[model samples]
Target: MATLPVLGGKVFLTDSGGAKHLVKAGCDIFMSTGVTHRLTEILGFAAGFALGFEGKDATHPGQRIKVSEMGTALLGQAVAKPVGSGKGTGLSVIIRKRKNWDDIAWRFTRQDGS
Candidate 1:
């Protein structure tokens, strides 16, 4: 097997067998697996938000790196056929709401009318 992509110092989920991996959104595998697997959210990731991901396009191992969009909903869609050979590994990409200190402060202020 090829050396798989690893999302070090990044947010990721662990499988039942204790494998850590990062997957893309809109992938057929993710859609299917998300339904059956109970995914756990990992916290304490680096700053900035990840919006979404595109399928792997490079035929060579090092040719393609996973690309992600920032500051948007994590919605998964089907990847293009040529790019996504359905042979990709990893579980799936997960999207979480990014809340900054300002956002939190404002929410509290509104609730308390302060």
Candidate 2:
């Protein structure tokens, strides 16, 4: 059995020659010794329930999975600003101001802008 580092309170594990698995907090893994183990020990074999290996591939134990190229492009399109909008003059400005001011106007305006 292969084990990965705990990150964000979740553990990722993979078999020697098979699919990867994500083990969340409080989940139990049963060992071959007929004893139960938590996320700290060996994980039992899981088959037929593959979480697709597209954007979730990690090369090293603690390496983070990054947004795939297609995912990044799609996200950029989804949040793209309209043409002719002035730079740093919209919600970004409001957010910057709200960090220093707790006034009712700033709070309400930030909510509306968000």
Candidate 3:
């Protein structure tokens, strides 16, 4: 696990099963991959196999959210600045492993209004 110090506490990040040893922020995958065409193989094999978001557009990763146009664009209705309406409102994005092709198909179908 990699711990990033926050203002009040630390945020710990971990990858229990992946190949890389050190999970430093902004680390280029190629240097740490330790396999032939490992990056290329991963890219071809999966879309969201990434432990965290892709950082090519930005300089770093993990700790700081990518502050870029595509990032902003994802938050289609986000405010001029990402300020919480009040202190209690916490924003987050959670990714979990999905099971069954039907479950996945339903999501794609819903998006298509089919």
Candidate 4:
């Protein structure tokens, strides 16, 4: 089983192959692998569902799955791949600031110099 930590808004990546990577805080929202995993914290932990790779072509160094804050799901079929190889895999959820109307307006104005 794989495991990650959810502490202080920071993300920790741990694959089944004993590989560990600490993702910087405020970078990725959260992630899960294709195995029964855990999201540990200082006080306790939560279990995560396995994103099974039963019918996948690439196993280890699995496909990179990036989920945006807008609920948009992006698969790394033609883009970035994972770190290692195996039947185990994980997901990366991006934490992004939501754009507001004012932000959009400012961007538009800046682009048009109006």
Candidate 5:
């Protein structure tokens, strides 16, 4: 678990093997696998759901799922896109385990099929 500041205010990534990373921020902390780290702006009631998601390797147990500062603001507003056009307002970060993704994926696949 580590902390690194996110500057661009956005994260876009594709699926890949499991690697560990930490979001270094004073206000918030979260962890996720290298490949699965996804960020989309939180919107609607889904915003609440998004906030509830736990990021892997988070320093605080309660904050398993976390979002950026802009995320919280946009969520409260319940806007689809950011107030000003340009890019989106908030981001949604995908979280995954570093130890073993195949194991988790296979396990869930069985349950889903059942």
Candidate 6:
């Protein structure tokens, strides 16, 4: 199977025993619209896979809800900012590991006062 070059050598096995590389954290999948709904959708898919939200049981609804809400809020913030205000027009989705989700979310929440 093809693997992303940025993943380097980190690999893991799926339930089906297929080998896959772990996505690099803080990697930016860029697009024309920075933080727009469309961009968020792309980012969400990457986040979901990196965070193990794919083909998983819904036993952890709370964590899922938090991530969803955080994404929404981030989208809103991106939309609210003016396009040419030095923030640039490109959007980058930061992909992180499942283990670091809580700490990352907390930092974002505290930083944004949300």
lDDT of 1 by residue, 31-94 (tens): 2344434331222122123322223344434345555333333358443233333557422344
Q: Model 2, which residues run further than 4 Å from truth?
A: 8-10, 28-114
Report the lDDT tens digits of candidate 5 across residue range 1-114.
333335845332322256444444443444564234233222333554444443543444544444534322544665454333355534444564444433432111223485
TM-score of every prediction relative to native: 0.16, 0.16, 0.18, 0.15, 0.19, 0.17
- Which tens-of-lDDT digit does each residue in 51-84 have in candidate 4? 2112222322355544322333357555454443
Give a tens-digit lDDT track for model 6, residues 1-114.
334444354332222234233333354333233246466667766765666533322444334322221222354364443333354432333433566455544111223576
- Clash totals, every prediction: 2, 0, 0, 5, 12, 0
Root-mean-square deviation of candidate 4 = 19.8
**Weakest 10 consecutive residues of candidate 3 by summed lDDT:** 101-110
Candidate order by lDDT, decreasing, is 3, 5, 6, 4, 1, 2
Give the per-residue lDDT of model 3 (tens digit) for 59-84.
34255544422223245666454444
Q: Which pairs clash in model 1?
A: 26-76, 26-77
Task: List where candidate 3 sits over 4 angstroms from the true fold.
Answer: 1-36, 48-91, 99-114
lDDT of each: 0.36, 0.35, 0.45, 0.37, 0.41, 0.40
Candidate 1 global lDDT: 0.36
Cα lDDT for residue 89, candidate 4: 43
Weakest lDDT window of 10 consecutive positions for candidate 1: 40-49
Q: Any idea how many clashes model 6 has? A: 0
- Largest lDDT belongs to which candidate? 3
Q: Kindly give the stretch of ten consecutive residues in candidate 2 with the minimal lDDT sum.
A: 45-54
Assess the local accuracy of residue 74 in candidate 1 as a C-alpha lDDT between 0 and 100: 37
